[model samples]
Target: MDNDFSVDLDDILATLRSHDIVIARFVTVHRRLLFDFRSTPLDPPLVAAVDPLPSIEARYRHLRELRPRLGDPPKLVTVFWPRFVASLADTPAWQAVRGRLSASGHPGAVESADAALAGLVDLERAAQREAILGGRAFRTIWSASPSPR
Candidate 1:
C-alpha cells in the first residue's frame, strides 16, 4: 500500500509571492552606501559627518596593526569603547602602553598608536552619523569593529 499526499500549489505560490514582495521592499528602502565615504556630491551635513573621518575599515585595520598586543579587532574595539566614555585621547590603556613603548625608545610608535586610536573614534562617529541619516536606529559596528572585508 502507498500513501498519497495532497499538494497546495496555490498556498505555495502565495507564500513565494509574499517573500518576493518583502525582498522588493527591502531593496528599495534599505539602500547601503556603496563606499564608506560618498563619491558623488552629497548633502552638506552628510559630507561633514563622513568626510572628516578616515575610512572605517582601513582605520580599524591600522589600529589593530598598531596595537596587536590588544588582541583581535573585535576584542580591541570592545576594550576601547568603554575607555572612550570620558575621553578619546586619555584612555588609561593608551597611557600605560605609551609609557612602556616610550621607555623602550621605539620612535614614532607612541605617536602612531595615538593617531590610530583618535582615528578609530572618528570612524565610530562617522558610522553613527551615517546610521542616523539612513534612519537606522541600530547598527552592527557601533563598537567601531570595522568589517574584516
Candidate 2:
C-alpha cells in the first residue's frame, strides 16, 4: 500500500494534497484534538464538491498519518461526521485554530471549505464552539479544501 498514509518523521509532509475541511473538533479525554470531519467539501458554496472517501480504510489511513503531524501520539483523531446541516464558521474558533496551526508552522490559509467547516466542530464547549463557528460567512477568503477527510 504505497499510498497508505503512515506518517513518520521521515515523511514529514509540508502540505497535504487533499482538501477536506478538518473541523477541529476539540480536545479529547486524552488531551488530543478531535478533528471530526467529512472527506469531501460539505458546503458547495465554500468549495467545489469532491469525490467521497473511496472507502473507510482510506479515511482511517489519512487520520493515522495526520494525527502525528498535529502533535504526536494522541495528537488528533477524526471523530465522526454528523448529519447534513448548513453550519457556519465561527470567526474566533476558526482564527484561533488557524493561529494555533500557524504557530505550529502550518498556518492555515483562509478558504471556503475552511469557512464552511469552521462551524462543524463537535464540541460541548459552547463559547469555544461559537468561536470556531461564529461570525459572518467568509465568502471573501479564497482557499479550497478539495481533498478527502
Candidate 3:
C-alpha cells in the first residue's frame, strides 16, 4: 500500500495507531536464527490525528517505551533458521521464560547453509533495529531527495 508519510505528525500518529506498530528482531547465537516481535505504541494514546505538534518527542516517548518490551533484541524462543536461529535463540536467555527450546536442522531448506549463516553473522549487528522504517509507513530517509541548498 502507498503510505503518504508527507502528512502531518498527527497523521503519522494516526497512521501508526491504525496498525499494530511492532519492532521485529532477528537474532542468533551458536547456530540458530529466530524472529522477535514487540508492540510499539503511539503517544497521546487515542488523540485524533488533527494538528500535529512540531516536536515528535510525544510520539517518540511512546516509541521508546517499546524498548522495554523489545528487551535488548527481538528475543523470541521460536527458531526460524538453525545456527543463525540458534544464535538468535541464545541471546535472549531472560526472554526464554518457558524453559529452553531447540532448533531443527533445515538440511533441505537451503543449498548453501554455510553461506547463509555467514551472511547472517555479517548482518547481525546492522539488522538489529526498530521495525518502524522496516514497515512502509515512513519512506527510508536515505532514499529521500536532498533539500535545495
Clashes of each: 0, 11, 15
List clashing residue pairs in candidate 1. Answer: none
- Full-model lDDT for every candidate: 0.33, 0.32, 0.30
The weakest ten consecutive residues by lDDT in model 2 span 9-18
The residue-level lDDT of candidate 3 at 39 comes to 24
Highest TM-score against the true fold, candidate: 1
Per-candidate TM vs. native? 0.35, 0.26, 0.18
Cα lDDT tens digits for candidate 3, 13-101: 33223332312223332222221223233211111111222344543454445344443432212212223322432333312311211
lDDT of 1 by residue, 4-54 (tens): 333343543343222211100111112111111111122110101112124
Ranking by TM-score: 1, 2, 3
Error of 3 at 130 (Å): 12
Question: Which candidate, 2 or 3, would have the higher lDDT against the true structure?
Answer: 2
Q: Which is the winner by lDDT between candidate 1 and candidate 3? A: 1
TM-score pick, better of 1 and 2: 1
- The TM-score, computed over Cα atoms with residue i paired to residue i, of candidate 3 is 0.18
Q: What is the C-alpha RMSD of each candidate to the true structure, in Å?
A: 23.7, 19.0, 18.9
The candidate scoring highest on lDDT is 1
After TM-score superposition, the amount by which residue 13's alpha carbon in candidate 1 deviates from its true location, in angstroms, is: 61
Candidate 2, residues 67-112, lDDT tens digits: the string is 4233222222232212122222333333443443333332233354
Once fitted onto the true fold, the runs of candidate 1 whose alpha carbons sit more than 4 angstroms away are 1-80, 83-88, 135-149
